[model samples]
Target: MLVTLEGLDGSGKTTVWERLRSDDMVPDETVFTREPTDTWYGDAVQRSIDDDDADSLAELFLYTADHAAHLSNTVRPALEENRLVVSDRYSDSRYAYQGATLADSEMLDDPLSYVREVHAPWTRPPDRTVYLDLDPETAAKRSGATNKFETADYLATVRDNYERLIEADPERFVRVDATADPDTVYERVRDAIV
Candidate 1:
């Protein structure tokens, strides 16, 4: 099974992933990856973040490249071996953040459709997508001002997009309230998968 955690910055995805790994709730054979993964492409994404670059399109392409490399080198092989794969973030984030950035740009008419047509075909969707829901204010407080993309306003829009994504595909997506305790959220995730 391939499980992915999706949420706004500071929604506790990294914490949850670490907890799951430490607890061995994530299978030993399971491979864990995150977007802006530790690759050259990922490094570029990180640089973009650090520089506070407004080139949303460049960031989007970097993320796409990272996803493609991650899938080809890691996720797909693990799946082929029948090992569960858990990812902290995936393609959905691109559709949310990049799409939001491109909302008013005449170039991005239908961001989802564009992503689906251009990038979706190259990647695999997760078996289950877990969205850790939290309010923008709370998310910002938790996240701090580390990344350029972690703004409260942007996260609010990302959260809304996540909700819409979930609503469109209820069967594959699970929304969990991250405002609760970590254990509570972990239990919910465990229950959902098992």
Candidate 2:
């Protein structure tokens, strides 16, 4: 099972993911990992985020490269050995965040289409996706000014993109109200898992 957790920053993805990890909630063969891996690909994305002049399209490409390395070097090997892979974030984050960032750009005819195209070969359909849904205001309060995309307006747009993704394929996503307490949210997350 390739279970990817998706949501805005400070949406309790880390908290819930930790619970899912330490609690031994998944099968015994579970392996936990995340994108923007610890490789140079990961470093490049991190650096890009801190770069004041980072282009939206360039940032998107950086993420795509990270995903490619993550799959080839980490995820696929674990899955090949029959381990259930639970990721902190996945391609959905790109579609939600970068796609929203590029939506207004005249550079691309269609940002989402271009993003989907860039990630087409490496995109792995999640067996299930848990989206910890929290409004931008609350999320901002939890994590203040983390990056360029941390603004309420931008996060709201990202949230909308996530909603659209879920709507497009309802079975692929399970929405969890992240405003609830961690324990309560963890319960919902476990229930949502296939």
Candidate 3:
């Protein structure tokens, strides 16, 4: 099973992911990963987070490259061997952030179509996506202002986009209230997985 968690920063995804991983609830060999993965492309993506040198389009391409590398190197291989794979984030984020960035540009008409034409050949969609839903105010309180992208306003927009994405593809997404305690969140996620 390929399970991907989606949410704005500080939505408790990492905390819940850690709990699930440490509890050994998935399997001994379950491959866990995060986008902006530890690769050269990922490095470029990370740098774009704060550095103003690159524009949003550049950031989008960097993230796409990282996803390509991640798919070829980690996700594909693990799935081929029948190991469960869990990711902290995935392509949905690119669509949300980049779509928002491109909102003022011509690409806003069909951001997903653009991404599909450009990156879909190498990427694989997650079998299930769990979006940890939270208010931007609460999420900001949990995650400090470290990046320009983590603002409450942007997060709120991200949340809205996430919901729209979920609505657009109901079968793949499971929205969970993230304001609950970690244990409660983990239990809900576990039940969803089972």
Per-candidate TM equals: 0.94, 0.95, 0.92
For residue 188, give model 3's deviation from the true position in Å.
Answer: 1.1
Each model's lDDT: 0.82, 0.87, 0.81
| Model 3 regions lying over 4 Å from their true place | none
Clashing pairs in 3: none
lDDT of 2 by residue, 53-116 (tens): 8988889989998998898888889888988888999999998999888999988886766787
Relative to the true structure, candidate 3 reaches a TM of 0.92
**CA lDDT of 177 in candidate 1?**
92
Candidate 1 C-alpha error for residue 51, in Å: 2.2
Error of 3 at 144 (Å): 1.1
The residue-by-residue lDDT of candidate 3 on 1-194, one tens digit each, is 78998888898888877877876556788888998798888888888887855677777888888998899999999999999889989889887777666565664577655755676666799999998888988877788968877788877777777777887789999888998988888888877765
How close to the true structure is residue 17 of candidate 2, measured as C-alpha lDDT?
77
Q: 5, model 2: CA deviation in Å?
A: 0.3
| Model 1 TM-score, 2 decimals | 0.94
Extract clashing residue pairs from model 2.
Answer: none
Clashing pairs in 1: none
Native-vs-model 2 lDDT?
0.87
